[model samples]
Target: MNKNWSAFNIVSVVFGFTFLYLPIVLLIVYSFNASKLVTVWGGFSTHWYSEMLSNQGLMDAAWVTARVGLLSATVATVLGTLAALTLVRHTRFRGRTLFTGMVYAPLVMPEVITGLSLLLLFVSIGFERGFWTVSLAHITFSMCFVAVVVQSRLVSYDMSLEEAAQDLGCTPFEAFYKITLPVILPAVIAGWMLAFTLSLDDLVIASFTSGPGATTLPMKIFSQVRLGVTPEINAVCTVLIGFVATGVIIASLINKRRMVNNARTDADI
Candidate 1:
């Protein structure tokens, strides 16, 4: 029985790893391929990377996407933090459950529904679908992710600290800024990073909201891929993968360091 279980566990672990990482491995390998066809690897070369950099349209689209991601992430983080604070701290309110549901509804709702609704709203309102529209759509979805992250952090938080600050004569606003904010800032930052990544990766919502002139990198890549595989797209994907990996690593390190410092402080106390 033990032998069979051990073998099963080993197989499960191997399958899990393969399922999660095989696509990433393939993407990285194809990014280095010199051939235009993704499956056919002619040879390894940095030529595609150079070509990607030189493509003016792709570059512009990338810049636009970055700007939209940054702006939307910022907006989402702020709004989400506020929503989390309200939901966690203020317990007594009429329609509070409804409000909370509305705030988090996007997280569970289908992306297609969200995209279609936003597109229809934009059309009805006569809003020109472009960068701002895309940013707004991103904020709507990304804010829910931020809210969930911040709320989880807040759940583990001790409210007595804020009360202690207030008892010492600090105003509520000052107490939040000096005490509550410090404790939750790491989570807030993490939420912001999460929002940024989601916004950057979003395609369906952006496609629905974006106009012709404000094409994002993902939109451009999707258009190109319909025609055939291109080394340039692989190169772009490689860069995106690198950026996301670096961001995740940095965030993990920062969280680990904070945890270590917190443990030491607790020991001292």
Candidate 2:
């Protein structure tokens, strides 16, 4: 409990953060530059933001990314939560080791490999590769991440509460719905947010899985960057950074509050 940050730790933390966020900080700062040339700072202005808003292609890509992220994250959250529950509650089941390895395999697999495999599977099945295909590819990888997050939370969870609810006449489904689910709700929400951000930020997998008219924001930005890094792209990237940062902050606050409430409830009991 007497943990304290050493000077070395402090310096390392500062250095690490600087290394990670320095580029992002510069990008955000330069997004407002009035110059057409990305390197030149004519003055501070919102010209690029306006241009970003007016670009039809960029808007379309943003819309597609948002929808894909929402759909994939939601479905992944559900499937992942169910998978976590199964792994935790039915540990002795046949092939449990194989199941566990498979669930976490995507977490370590290269994005290129996962994307290529999914693409091949879709082609083999003759599935049209478009918005749905990209979303499915995202879900395929995102669910594994979600499972890891939710499963960690489930591992330390006491199953007695659910058992007590069941003993009091609640069905197994009802017990989980009312008892176990609430305790793990914070982890579920965190998993969903993480999945959404991953989907939004994905370029390699999206590039592999996406078909015509299914371009995501990252893919659009990447394509544009290949041509040139424009102020418009910087503005778009700044906006995305803000969006993801806000989601992360909100998720952290919610988790912190939930933990505080849980602690208070436990102390009172």
Candidate 3:
């Protein structure tokens, strides 16, 4: 098997990454533009960043987004972890196939359809569409993603550890808390992060579900974008990219450290 990278391979790799990130790089660079116009750069400055901080609408949207993301992610993680356990630990239950299908259907379902359906359901229920409605909608879609992530991890898990814990007189809950939960914590965290990102980035679902005074950051950005791309939008996007990148890096480092510690403990045993 050939292991060396050809010139063509190197070019392809570079081109792919450039194509993916060049726009982001340009946006970040232009966020510092002194000019109000995005394309016409008038020297590097932090004017947009300053202006963004002072924009009350943007700040309120950011708060709403943060709240929705946190609430939805936390709830989705719990529900998803439970669903994964139900599918993995409990075998041959009635209606299992139906439940599994429902859990997975959202993954391939169109966002427009999901959003519209959710909106209709809420309207039928006479539920007021606002922050809670948006959060509920987010949880509905994000939970499936979390379930899929945790399910993948659960499939490869060793069941013997839990059985041994039970044999040592641990109750079912205790066994899960001490043995099974720790082993699958990484997947759970990954699911939470995925859910949070989805909730944070979703515009379509949020737009459909959200009501007056509950605008999300993405929705706010979309409204502004309709007028035209401004340096302010560029600054907001840059900040969002930075925040997400930092979170992913930190989570990765924590997971890596946990894995290393687990490996060391196993070696010592």
**Candidate maximizing TM-score:** 3
Off by over 4 Å in 3: 1-3
Instruction: Look at candidate 2 and give me any clashing residue pairs.
Output: none
Identify the runs in model 1 with alpha carbons over 4 angstroms from their true place: 1-5
Error of 2 at 169 (Å): 1.2
Model 2, stretches more than 4 Å misplaced? 1-10, 267-269
List per-candidate RMSD values in Å: 2.0, 2.1, 1.5
Q: For residues 74-161, what per-residue lDDT tens digits would candidate 1 score against the true structure?
A: 9999999999998898898999999899888998898888999999999999999898999999998998899999999999999999
Q: How many residue pairs clash in each candidate?
A: 0, 0, 0
lDDT of 3 at 232: 93
> Would you list the rank order by lDDT, best first?
3, 2, 1
TM agreement with the true structure for every prediction: 0.94, 0.94, 0.97
Each candidate: what lDDT?
Answer: 0.92, 0.93, 0.95
- Estimate the lDDT of model 2: 0.93
Candidate 3 lDDT, 1-269, residue by residue in tens:
35688888989999999999999999999999998778997998998899999999999999999999999999999999999998888778999999999999999999999999999999999999999999999999999999999999999999999999999999999999999998899999999999999999999999999999999999999999999989999999999999999999999999899889989999999
